[model samples]
Target: MKKKKYNTLWLSFLGVTAIPVLAIFIITMVVARNEFYEMRAIYGPNFIPATRESILMILIFVAGLILVANSLWMIWMKGMVIKPLRDIEAAAKRIAKGDLEFTIVTQRTDEIGELCRDFEEMRRQLKASQDARIYTEQQQKMFISNICHDLKTPITSIQGYVEGIMDGVATTPEMHSKYLKTIHNKANEMNLLINELTMYNKLDMDHVPYDFKEVNLKKYIDDCAEDLEDELATRGVNFGYRYNCADDVTVKVDPVQFSKVIHNLIGNSVKYMDKEDKRIDLRVKDYGNSVMLEIEDNGMGISEKDLPRICDRFYRGDSSRGKTKGSGIGLSIVKKIVGDHGGQISATSKVGLGTTMHVILKKSAGGKNG
Candidate 1:
């Protein structure tokens, strides 16, 4: 389309320029014919005055031709080149003044049109970058605010517990022990928050170290589930495990970091459990090239709106916030760890039904059994 328009523009300019030149040619021919006949009739093939008149007529005709040509050239240039350039200049000025909304419209197929298209693309990219920067700034501010509040909650608790112990309020040994334990728990929470912050910083900086190893998936998850079984049982939650893989099924992973992933998911499930038949199920399945680990729970599920952002740093679901305590970076850390191990994680849930967390890891080349 633009190519056709460009060709058409050149053709039109040629046509416009030809019309005046053709008119001037006809006028000069008529003047020369009249001068020839007038000189012959008036002076009988005269030499001096007739020659003077003819010279004057020729000069006038040349001047008129020059004037017409100049006028037409100016008109053509203004329409084809100057106006578009002026538009571009004006748009540029507006952009310099921080007005990104200005648009440059052109119908030329020449260099100027290409320039306009490039300028538009640049403006769009700038706008997108500005928007992303603003969003990131807003998110950072919100994170800082939430971190301060989260830290304050535990710090305030620790301070209160310490004050109680110092004031002789816990005169009994049991009371003293309880207060000290509370203080310890609060301190632990603060430490966990700080640790999560540090881990997130490392992840952001691409500096989190991993020690990858090939391990049997069945035994690995079994051990993890077994470690949590006692705790779940003590809390009256039925725990179940299913390993639907061959005996030799294995995956390469950083065991410690991967274990953190499992722990965080199970901890989240336990924290949100509100069912009469409280249950946590751990399942492992072997795909041809990968293994899947799923931890599901009969807990208060996440809303559809909140499910997508659950793994984002410091994003706490409204339902989970009131019933449980968390540093809000656990799932984010889990996601980062899974990603670093060349795996993926996702969650599926329906409100009031249950939530299932899935982790998919590539199978190790050496599928050695435990």
Candidate 2:
């Protein structure tokens, strides 16, 4: 109890007030008889020293006790309560004044110390929140600026072509049709940017609405490949799909979001296709407790520096093969969706050769869910 932080104040009170009082009392009793005669001489021969001496002793003892108590109270109040409160007050003022450049220090192990520590923790958290808010605001501004920069080019091109048609600059029927097609393409590009922005904002979270359901992996991917083959063929790109997994291989995934992930991956491959003999191959395999999906493309591969950051939101590379690499959020969406579904996505690429994207999803319990 004596070693406790709160109990020490009680001990200090006893030492300064009650213990000193007991000592003062004992000394007065010891000297009472001797002081009686001295009191008689001082008061006068007829004076009643017996009663009056007792009064004087009581008065002196009471006065000394009051004086000691007042001194102790002043000392304790200044050191224990007042000084700490003042320091905390100063800290509050500094924090209120928008300054977070200092630290709080205290050596006492009492309630004051705990209060100081808590206050410091609050300040530290507040500083961190403030810093994070500032960074987020900066990133938001950059995002808006990037969107504006990208939108300006297409918007200007569309305007110029429309003006050309109106100004009769596209006089021939062929020129008019070409101008109309270019304008339509530019408008589509703008719409794609808007869609990417909307999707990115939705996926930039930990708890996206993932409706997980068990599905045979091969059959699901086969359907996806079937849908994409016709589209790729229209663009003169060959598409292939392979499965080395068991017929009963199954995994839990959100059907809608997973389809987007597949399309986005292939979309990137098609976007970077630089060779006339464009080709894309997708394969799936069972790997113990996880299933691996790979998409390889004969496209202009990402450079060493850009490969690492390719999936980062709004990151654009130096490759000029694709007219514009898009709004730069497709692969980020892929990663986000994959991670939300308790999976992983990665890529490997070499410039001028090709690239392979790997996605691994945890196999469902009872892998052969037949």
- Pairs that collide in candidate 1 are none
Question: What does candidate 1's lDDT look like per residue over 305-331, in tens digits?
Answer: 999989987778988764566656788
In angstroms, give how far residue 368 of model 1 lies from its true place.
9.4
Against the true structure, what is each candidate's TM-score?
0.75, 0.64
lDDT string, candidate 2, 261-369, tens digits:
9999999899888999999999997777898899999999999988897887766686742356466678889999998889999999988989999999988887863
Clash list (residue pairs), candidate 2: none
Clashes of each: 0, 0
lDDT of each: 0.82, 0.84
Off by over 4 Å in 1: 1-43, 46-124, 321-324, 368-370
TM-score of 2: 0.64
Clashes of 1: 0
RMSD vs true structure, all candidates: 7.3, 8.1
TM-score winner among the candidates? 1
